[model samples]
Target: MTETWPARFIAAERYRRHRYAANHPLAIPRVSLTLDLIHSYAALSAEEYLVSRRASEDELAWFHTAEYIEAMQAAERAGKVSRASRQRHNIGNLENPYFHDFFTTPATATGGSIQAAEQVLAGYLAFSPAGGMHHALPDQARGFCFFNDPVLAIMRLRREGWRVLYLDIDAHHGDGVELAFRDDEQVLTFSLHMDTAYAYPFIGGGWRDWGVLGNALNVPLPKATRDGEYRWIFGQLWPRVLRAFQPDAVVLQAGTDILLPDPLGKFAISTGFFLELVEEVLHSAPRHPHGVPRLAVLGGGGYHPLTLARCWTGVWGLLSGRRLDEALPEAGRRVLQAVGWDEDEDEDYYPVLFERRVEAAGDGPPREAIRRLAGDLLEQHPLWRGMT
Candidate 1:
């Protein structure tokens, strides 16, 4: 958490095809709001920026199926689709309805994520709030994501011989990441998402889907999970994961979707709790892997504009090792208002969503739940197992 660690963030000046329609939560003021807030905080250098562009066919060919990419681009450019594109790629599907230049936004997110992995390899703590599209497949887009940035990034890192510990705190399971690395031993992906029974992406993220070499870990929480419930299971699960993976580094998908007001989730976790989880991960996870630098990607499931920025700001603050300001600065507010204003739906948006209350259990999870779940995991394995 040093300024020396280089808190890199990625965003673009190119106009992203921002929304599908009015009132869709994904259509709200998000990534740009985050960029505005970070700029206001003055944590990043204006000169040291990284923005992603529409990925070339060559780059897309690396991870995605070429036919799918061709159809996607063709449909996007024409601003209409033929039956073949729709039938084959599910582009016309309700969740990810085709839009102009569809490849541009997700491609930016994808390229930025790949760049983040490369930067982390070069010893910088780079982040792309645009990445973490955990739903896209090699052949088709799923959820709202047309390109799976996290999966592509992990694939790139694994190709470089890095033993990766991929951790996600998004309310939705990183289904695509799990499937992409489902059988790979070089990468260990652990997701703590809302259980499939009552959540989006209702297919995977269960514990039983563990990988071929035992490299996957999925712990699903029921709806409305409080701070105690989430931290409880994660506390038990993470130690075992890091212990067994013995990673060279860690990648965290710190999606704000776990927040209660998040349009996609029912979890009631707070911003402070989110910040604490980050603190613990940055401090604890690396030790087992010999103190490798960890890179984080902003993941899914946030719609409340204010909540999204505030939650992400905590991550920025923690990485900067700075105190969280009690109030949102006007500059941050202006940026949020700008995104929301252009969308022209919610005019009265502010960055701090929750009513500003800290949990009684201090920064960690409830002592009782932690003691109960972690006791069993600890009893099964010694601390040094994680380090080795």
Candidate 2:
């Protein structure tokens, strides 16, 4: 057999065994659920299996302070929290509560992301479903994220001489990532998220938060934007960035919450459109914000279990270059049912959502929404000043 792109999957059954309590946003058995989906449906070859290993202390130190890791370790030892620890790092809190594997489980996910980036750098299209913890900050974590994996990966790639283009499609703003490289010119961050006032991580994502690189780009759309508007803004930002910096690698966080039924997000995008979006990324092979074209696609944040699985399964299949049959395969459906996810038979899984979706403001996109946003953004970026 021809040696295909060296694919890898970073997961451990142990990670699923040690999980958050049920009903919490982070409780779903992500790697396990995704594993079951692939086992039943995907034509995954042996090479794609890249089980996760915890990122080493030095790796964590790349993007996190020792004190932060110290705080996490201390929180782990006590099991039950004490007042002193609480005051130091806010260990046990409403949002980022202590979970079963609070200390190390997230590390596996972070490690997996780092591994994925390594494979991509080695010249293969790589993905780590456990990655995209974009909410974790260097000093602390919020929103069930303990460490920012993608940030760590970008920092790692930078040390190796690759200019990185960070793309986040999570419904919530990628505040942690944006903050980490906010001042560094080597990294260019692009985010399209639901407006902060209406979503979690509610403090940022303003287009004006342009990082020190003056390369940060934000498209804060109103709720209910569908394929057209979503594509428009992305269309605008991606082209200009490619023209300017021409990145060597692009890290995309494909969080599924933007789908219609996701509790955490308000947008009603379907999975089909997402496949096309990635397709475009490969087709254009943007001007290297880095030295070569590569990708590290990841699962950022999605609360709905089955929906998340369905959305990402498409991503995996797309990367493999196989067309999905519109009808869900029986074996795949059986796999989903094993996890108590019933099929929404009426739904279509390709090209467009079963329903004809619209943009935000309850009206479809205006003729110039894409041009206006892209035009406005380009006017301020350094890439436009001859970087490309």
Candidate 3:
């Protein structure tokens, strides 16, 4: 409803119907819930809601291989991956399983991401709630992502002549996206994720593993990292990186799995902290040499349906210049209540719109460890120097 913000919500109803099969971590509704909740709160109007378009094979080929794309399409049509396909592409593995509409579903999300990129290049803020499948490879599926939508989106933006500042705030490292642009100077990647000992894609993102071109900074936070710790490190590093990179556009992989209740993640952040980072990125964009820097926001890896709905809905609100209220509206409450989960442990306490205050876990690694993490990263002098 607010015209001043100049934002659009890129989503599709097909996300509700074509989802991961039962028993999968991604089986629960995400984008649909966020869309419904945003509608319920009157945060997005009909004019602002754009139906997602499906990515064509040609568009998909911008990132994925033609043979892999054909294999995925074949698997989708047959409702299964062939033995060879499974072995080569990791398609039927437990992490990335064969499911109905696998190709088209991810293609739709990819298309939305591309559209969001176009909108950002045109000087509009675009949030694609279904994008950010950051773990998929160009030829293989990994960590439940069939297509690396964020990579494709960023690659498209780069082709249009924008120096990209990629910030990933997922609990799990964005290995796929990081690997995609590791050697490219046009895109500077910074990821703040959980330590690999407890997270998925349990490789890379350490302090020492700067990308081939040293354009990447991977700050691996220890387990149970709370808001204070996240805020401290992000504040220390991001401004310097932004000032150094001076990107023409910013793309954020906003994955809320770091929220406390998420079953798949280990961090203890709140929805508020997540929004704070997003707001910071949005505000910094205007300072770029390119007048009115563009931003493309993508949803990444949140597992809990309630957290996904609240965090992303809050993101949509912030993108549109609305702030969070302690108490949610009645319609919003109904939307949260309708969310069905496999477990019924905390139904009474689930619908709160704001993250509950949580003390930093003293049992995890000490603050000095985090300081050392940053120090070691700074010791990679050339990477830091390039930005300066």
Candidate 4:
């Protein structure tokens, strides 16, 4: 039996102090809420919780351009940006708006992922709930990500001479990370996201876009993709890639936006399916020579606060080997109740959201598009073809 590795949850109180501009998809509380839900369950012990540090300018320079970093800092300082800076760096725009602590907030998140990577390298299973800002480019921001923490974290692992597999399950394509390492043979990037035709960052997720060295695989799921279809695709594809690549470490971007209730996500995935995905990854993750699982999990997009909290809390429970009580404790209930829902939205489903039980969005046979995509990838991709 594989020994259970100690788990660390990386977070910071600063996340609560920062907020995106009003009415933005990310304006809702994510990291802070997940921290509360886990604490409500008493799932984390003092030893397992690590306070996140802010990424210094030197650290951000790992994946970000120095000019872009300075632009972000200037925007935050002025609460605005020059037209040239805005256009050049993609800051102070609708997609990547400026707010208080714009640079520091993402820098802190980057720091969390960096810390998680460090912990994983030290032979522990670590998670940075504030990480997985995968869509930010080296010189620009895209898809609500201002800094690409996932890229930086992967780079940290790469410096140690470890081959890293970056598995992104965000609803949107992990375009930034894929772009960063597509030419590098040491890092393999696999993304399963909503098809670009129907999602944000609307390009570059086609199954055939396998990277320069065939080290990248992009699987775009159709809108409203159910639990069964997701399982079928992941089941058929992930194990094949794992066997062929045999990565020394795996970085999982577990974005909860794929959940059924998320307004921004069209898929009907359930919390149960999400946990199953994490569990499977944990079970099959590769270990270091010292028998420690070299896995670092990061959070991505999840707009629905209630669902995000529940999903991430369950993830921590799984990682820490704690059985969460199905009945929502009063403390957990209060945490859910405290969320400020948009006034324009209906509250009829409010009661259901408080319940800890989320029924699985049942799976069906894979659709023809999904089937064809899987077949094509397995048969055409060099990685799979080269596998014995």
Best by lDDT: 4
Per TM-score, the best of the predicted structures is: 4
lDDT of 2 by residue, 1-388 (tens): 1222444565667665866756567776566776776766665777777778889989999988898887787777767545665566566776777866667877888888898888777766777888899988777776878899989988877878888889888898888888898778878888888878788878884666776667687877777878777877777668777767667678888887787767688987766676678777755653333333488787788886766776676677666655556455677666555665333344443222222221223226634655665677768655577653
lDDT of 3 by residue, 272-383 (tens): 7777788888777743234443788999998988777888988988787776564566777677668756363655444333333222242333488898887777666355
| Model 4 TM-score relative to the real fold | 0.96
- Number of the candidate with higher lDDT, 2 or 3: 3
Q: lDDT of all predictions, in order shown?
A: 0.69, 0.73, 0.81, 0.88
**Runs off by more than 4 Å, candidate 4:** 1-3, 342-350
Best-to-worst order by lDDT is 4, 3, 2, 1
| CA lDDT for candidate 3 | 0.81
Give the TM-scores of the predictions, in the order they appear: 0.85, 0.88, 0.92, 0.96
Deviation from native of the Cα of residue 135 in model 1, angstroms: 1.3
Q: Candidate 2 at 41: error in angstroms?
A: 1.6
lDDT of 1 at 263: 58
**Count of steric clashes across candidates, in order:** 2, 14, 0, 1
Q: For model 1, what is the alpha-carbon lDDT of residue 160? A: 83
